[model samples]
Target: MPLARSLRLARLHPPQVLALGFIVIIAIGAFLLNLPIAFHGARDLPFLDALFMSTSATCVTGLSVISPGEDFTLFGQLVILTLVQLGGLGFMTMATLVALVAKRRITFKERLILQEAMNHGSVEGIVRLIRRVLLYSLVIEAVGALLLSVRFLLEMPADQAIYFGLFHSISIFNNAGFDLFGMFPGRPGSLIGYVDDPFVNVVTMVLIFLGGIGFIVIDDLLHFRERRKLTLHSKVVLSVSLFLIVFGGLVILVFEYTNPLTLQKLSFPEKMLSSLFQSVSMRSAGVTTLDVGGMRQATQFFSILMMFIGAAPGSSGGGIKVTTFAILVGAVIAMLRGKEDIVLFKRRLARDRVNKAITFTLFSFFFIILGAMILSVTESYDFLGILFEATSAYATAGLSTGLTPQLTGFGKALLMAMMFVGRLGPVTLAFALTPKHEKELVRYPEGKITIG
Candidate 1:
């Protein structure tokens, strides 16, 4: 009753309310994970760091101030990775799917929340679709784990290798990017031990790419099963994802071929594999087998672009999303062509959708900028590096420029705030912050302003 009263008072819009619930739940999980009970050994982490880790995990962003490998025991690491799974799969999404599978009915309110969670259209077939998502996820991750374990078994004992393979398979497949090698000198050395292992790199990269491609796209592909006709959404996502993987991989391959900093010294096969890994990592995968900080400025800049773009909508990876990018590009083309309507694949675009896309893109860009500016003022690090980390956090991309660990207490707080906002998103956070609007009475005639 009290909760109901608060919701009524807050005029809680579904999205904002859902976001609040999510963040609060993640915070609680963070607290629990930091508790001594969740650890295999001593719990020595500061409260802020724990909360930050929790938020990062729950957001499915891999950014961390302390290495998970060194800072926490296996239990603690599992907790963080679990949170990542929850974050990516979405708390409400899992719940709704479970309810449906159990022959329980979802409330109308729950459907609305699920709609936003999956970014699917309306609330139609949501229950069935949610079940499909879960089933598909399990099947794909299982196969990925099987492939990944074979590689890991070659490097470690049976039990340990199997567990490691499972953990990493789930993590990469969720696009979580958290690793058990936090003790690995904060570089790619942890994974470097396996750099020459084709099976390991390939499996990990495949999981990361597939995981980042958004479940919505996955659903469409599964539904169509390579059908001659693909939905516009799936087509755009697949086309962009393919282009990014290939183009980004080729660029990294060419640039790092002999650079010594990245892949020049590696064997031809390893170099090719590393390039592929880095390219797949760009969609906010956060895994790395090469020293990102040692790469040339151009590579770093390109990486930033990839992170900014992030993954596809309704997927684990975070960013403005591939669909959003496609929409923005389509808008630009329409404007250039002097067409009043922005059309894609012969389908008319919706105004509210276009507005939402533009707003999301603008708000995301500004939010990152705001975070970077605040970070620049608060931290003494090189401005560009800090900015890169800030965007990485804001996009939930987790591809830091090696400045994450060195951030001051205040800087951590700033980043914590950014991570929270990034995870919740600007529009949702804005909705939470702003007072609810009442139905308006009068409509005012608008005068068109002269524009460029």
Candidate 2:
């Protein structure tokens, strides 16, 4: 009977399992954070605030209601950091570690879950991929921490500098964007104090880029010598990412060049640095060296577009995904050019893939609009601010216009829902909520549709 029950439990849908896993993690994190040890002083941390922070961390959305460094002690900070690491690397990937330690073969059901978790196309070599992913993440984070710690050593004590180094490195690489800079005087928030510091800016941008670029691309690049070529997916992700970064940076520079509150006071080099950082960070890093709230409306709107697009699939970041956006663009081009099939890199795109992309993009838009509409009514913020916050939460981009900290309870709850959906993805959630159905046995006749 116990064996049958275990088997039944294992047979649960992968999406449902993944979604529940995240919820469980968030609940535990929230509980831990609500403890007295988690805070610094006598002020009690509200359960709603604890849950908000936990959801943000576990989802890696970084929409904090309280300052981590100023409000929480080392214990709470560690909990948040652990949540970020787990969230950044999907919880299933972390489970692979336990399996490895136990010397147990990964069950087929678990492999399916890992496929869903990692956003991989198949179950083949899923365990191998997890191993490489873990190794790659640790090595990259180690180097990032080393470099950051060395730099920080020049500014603070050895012990604190080392901790800061490790913390920021993991946060940036995971695209979690939770920073400990708030405790310091004159630091303001985020990476704003490092606006003109080239070393800090460059290191951070590099980490953010790697974190968002997707692990498949990294694996392909590392194995290029053996494969002798990049996969079409890698090519598309790289090309689209490069284009977005450059385009975003240039647009930001042009729009904010003379804005007195942001880039105007900086020298040309400093301005360029800030612009590039914003471009990189907008994809989901959330750590900013510029005044995000002070940017022009045009700049903020443009940023909203970028945040909505978010990072590539299977990466730490979230959004509609680069491939989805790329396919949509391809579809439009093919329609305009009168091509029967969408083609990318001389390869014909599958019809199902195109349909899925359209469906996903539309669903994303619907949710973002829905969330924004609710926030607009519940909060006192302007339309743009509400929309930006909504999109940021849904994209898991974590960029904000200084509106997050002031949200009402309903607003915070709404954003948490957005973050959860953003992380698990709309389609996955749909599947989790939907009951299993048999394949359609009846085929409907085709009917002509009205013209656009």
Candidate 3:
């Protein structure tokens, strides 16, 4: 009976198993982070705080109760960075890479998990894809670190600059948004001090933009000889991402142009740079060069919408995703025209795909609203602030409105759950919740209900 029960439990579908894998890794991380050495001055981190940090890092969500630079020791920072990298690359992807490095054969089940994790269409060439992902990620992070180190050298000694550069390079590329600026004087206002520095702004934006665009798209662009040869998914992702960034930047620029606390004092070029950075960071990068708390109300609400849309699929970022949003828009357009199919760039989307997109978007909206509502009761923040915090966590965007560190334990737990669901995805969580063996084998006459 015990063996039977164990087998039944082990029979969880790939999504459920993948979710569990992240949970296990987070547990280990929490344990390591709770150690005395993880903190400065020999103070122990509370278990709940440790779990919250572990979940945030593992989910690649940048929301945190404590400043990484001021609160954690070097060992703790390393642990957080390790979680960010693993979470961004995904647990299964890293596992497959390790197996490959060890010269161990990968089983079909493992391939299935990797396929699901990467959202790939097939298992074919998955190993090769994993290899390319690892190689490309390392090279990109290394180049970013080198460039950032040169910039950081202006502020600190060589050794400190190098360490800060590496930490930020990993954090930015993973869209994790953990920052070391807290160690500096004044408030721990994330890259706010670097808003006028072109090198820092440009380099960090580039890293965030590249990382927000899905790795699959990067691989496709790299390998394809012609633009026409790129996959439809890649084309849609690129087009939507570019449009959102430009549009979001323009909106931010217009709204905050004269806001005294944000962009009013900046030069025209610096204003544009800060606007662009804000737009890109909202794509789930979580790093902010401007005072998010001081921005105009319009900008804050617009940012909430952007955070809800998040980034492209198969990327380190989260949200409903660019592709999902694109599909929903296409579907709406098709419906307005009374077309039977949703078409884009001469390609038609399947009915089920459109339905899934709508479902995911609705589910995302529901959770964001639910979280904000719950937090409004548990915390004393305004609705706008609560909604912003909820959306940021749901999108894993991590741009808080100064309400993060002020949350009650219950509020923090709610946001932690939102981050987990956001990272795993509403659809994936739905799959995990459903019974794996359930199937609709019998059908009756089709029934239709008219509404709207």
What are the TM-scores, per candidate, against the unseen true structure? Answer: 0.91, 0.98, 0.96
Tens-place lDDT per residue, model 2, 242-301, is 999999999999999999999999999999989989999997998999888999999999
Extract clashing residue pairs from model 1: none
Off by over 4 Å in 2: 1-10
Per-residue lDDT tens digits for candidate 1, residues 1-452, read 23323543665677776677677767787788778755544546787888878888888778888778777777788788778878888887766656656677676767777787787877888877888788888888888878877776776688877777777777788777777765545445336566677877878877877788888777777768567578888888888888888999999998778787778778887888889888888768777888778887788878877888888878888888888888888899999999988888788888887999999999888888888888898888877788788878877877777898888888888887877777777777787687776788989998898888
Alpha carbon lDDT at 14, candidate 1: 70
Model 3: clashing residue pairs? none
Residue range 1-452, candidate 3, lDDT tens digits: 22222423688677887788788889999999899989876567888888898989998988989888888889999999999999999987787776777788876767777788888879998878888889889999999999999998997999999998999999999999998888775765578889899999999999998899978999999979865598899999999999999999999999999999999999999999999999999879999988899998899999999999999988989999999999989988998999989999899988889889989999999989989999999999889999999999989998988998898889888988999999998888888888865579998999999979
Q: What lDDT score goes with residue 209 in model 2? A: 93
The stretch of ten residues in a row with the least summed lDDT in candidate 3 is 1-10
Top candidate, metric TM-score: 2
